[model samples]
Target: MVFKCQEDSFLKEFTSKVVTCTEGQLKTVIGGKITTLSCYEVVLEDTIFFPEGGGQPCDHGLMDNVAVLHVTRRGTEAVHFVESALPVGKLVKQKIDWERRLDHMQQHSGQHLITALADIYFSYPTTSWWLGEGESYVEFDIRSVKPLNLDKLEDLVNEKIRAATPVFVTVYEEGDTELRKVRTRGLPDDHKGAVRIVTIEGVESNMCCGTHVTNLSQLQTIKLLRMEKGKKNKMNLYFLVGGRVLQQLSACLHREHQLTALLKNGPADHVELVDKLQKSLKCANKNLQAVLREIAVREAACIKQQVPIPRYYSLHRKEADSDFMSILINEVGDESVLLFLTVGDDKGGHMVLYGEPATVAQLGPQVCALLNGKGAAKGPKFQAKISNLANRVKAEELIKQYVTCTTSGC
Candidate 1:
């Protein structure tokens, strides 16, 4: 219920008082009389909460020390809907969640840097940036962003970050404007008296109302997570910044420690260890598959020699998984009988019964209904989880009835 991003573009540890609150559905915030108000998110109303827009989430924190749950908008009027109700016409101080806010700022600022850099270094334009959960991304129209130049971009952004450069805003009156004259999608339809533009002193400037760091220094650093071509003439880049990068580094180190303990290798050898482990796994899996194939051949030969009994056949054992029954049933062929059952305590299984498509279609769902669980119908093989070996004889009889009696519909 948070209508974030409705206020001035700042995520400082600042506090303000609540001017009003709403109690009805929608629970909107109204300060001045309904007539004078803009009906949704206006700074003129002096409401503390930020309005939600531009894909960036709303600012969150406490209002009068109570957790603010929702910061929604009613037209241009922004409201803070909190866990604890506040009285209208009463002023309640509010604070912004700085950690979350700073992360957002870093991501927002980093995006501008990357976008500008792409235009500068790769001569590509950003199509859009879909800020993700924890991670942020910027999509560009460049087909190949080779070498990725992550380090170069990081250095360039940090230089701006370290410079502590001030960001400024300007609003242009309808007739006197040069910056707003250039447009990506063309001038906004609601061309009023003025258009707002944000500028970074020595680096770059563009039209944006999105919140950003007051001083570029707050961004610290930008760490590129990954980059890949998204579609024709498009590439997507994922990245992190400041505290988030630190957290990721910590996690990676711990994982490396775990690998070193098991592999008994130096930290720098992590790549070699991973490659060796993958190779070993592949060899082991290959050997296991060969053994399973050999076992399937021998077992099918034995089950194939069984008598052709329509609607009924079973091989019960205390320990055997589905592979045993499946091999035997398939090798027995499709023209003959159907119901083939197997029983086990440690291992669980079942096989075909009139395995024709229509028969399984009718029996499978019914069997699962009686068993109170789930199974698969693969070319007419149905399996059920039974509690004990005693269910074996009972299951065999059930299969016979289910297969032969069409009226049973199971």
Candidate 2:
């Protein structure tokens, strides 16, 4: 059955009698929240709504002022999922979401033009295609695409669009001899309608089951964004058609303006300025690391100079790293005094416990548990990553108590 939508893609209003309406549920995500809605599955005698198929999404519209959330084809029927139910025999006025319909038409028709030109000029047959929310692409049966060939293909596609080539659908009954010559992956098993061959006059004819513009001029323009590697030895040619091209341009310009302000340079100089900034940052980090190592050595020397070296010591540095920890450990070189050191922010960081072998084994597990950390004891050194640095004080107190008990024999 060729529905009214397929017959006249531009139709926005129609009157149809509801053939059936059944209670149903629909789940949708809005503003990052998943919401389930109670709805009615309605079948009309005729409709202007296009059901989801052929890589194009379903149309959303209204029936008798009730919101139509979605449409899907089941066998031969176009089921309309609506927010409210209507009587089975009631006649309702159906309206199309014209903006969405126009966008889909532009993209679908643009795809046919691109696919035909690719096969004709480059012998790259389209194995598959995707109509995404922001962009669309055709997967070709090639591993990679040359830049020159890609540029040539894009030019030819837009040239055809500018020529305003005629696009029309030719319907054939099943078993028609001409249908065999039309390009197609295959028809669905549940298909119960005449085959649709969408042809761009003087271009190509391909079997499709999606709504399209009547002329290539409706596409306005097509921009082949880039080519990306695809699965199974294929390449995907991503593109934006019609309004999407304009939208992408607007977004890019906005980001360019932001970068100009941030870099205090024009768009042409952004790359050079950013490269210089990165180099400067690298040099500064190198100098900071040297300073941290020197501080670590001085801290270790202070500990070693104590009148009667403290039995236990704890130090935490929010910005230090493992290199600083290693330098301090090497400088101290005393197994008699236990050293508890941590390096990280308040959120989390690395922890190290260095002391007598037996003392480390006994206190490592306790401190790890208190600070929500995990590590293993190796001889006189224990190292771990702590997740709850907020509990660092508690862990330190536990270490002090254990050292005091061992030294006082209490």
Segments in model 2 whose C-alpha atoms lie over 4 Å from true places: 27-38, 297-312, 321-410
Q: Per-residue CA lDDT of candidate 2, range 1-410, in tens?
A: 88899999999999999999999998887888998989999999989999999888899989999999999999889999999989999999999999999999888888889999999999999998999989999999998888999999999999998899999999999889999888899998999869889999999999998999998988999999999999999999999999999999999999999999999989999999999999999999999998999999999999999989888889988889988888898899987989999999867899899989999999998898888898989999999988888888889889988888887898
**Regions more than 4 Å wrong, model 1:** 1-20, 23-44, 72-75, 83-85, 148-151, 162-164, 171-178, 181-195, 306-327, 334-362, 370-397, 400-410
> Residue 170 in candidate 2 has what lDDT?
94
Global Cα RMSD, each model: 7.1, 3.7
Could you give candidate 1's per-residue lDDT for residues 128-176 as a string of tens digits? 8876657888887877666647667667767777778776666665455
Q: What C-alpha lDDT values do all the predictions have?
A: 0.61, 0.92
Clashes of each: 22, 0
Which residue pairs does candidate 2 place in steric collision?
none
Worst ten-residue run, lDDT, model 2? 399-408
TM-score of each: 0.74, 0.84
How far does residue 70 in candidate 1 sit from its true spot (Å)? 3.7
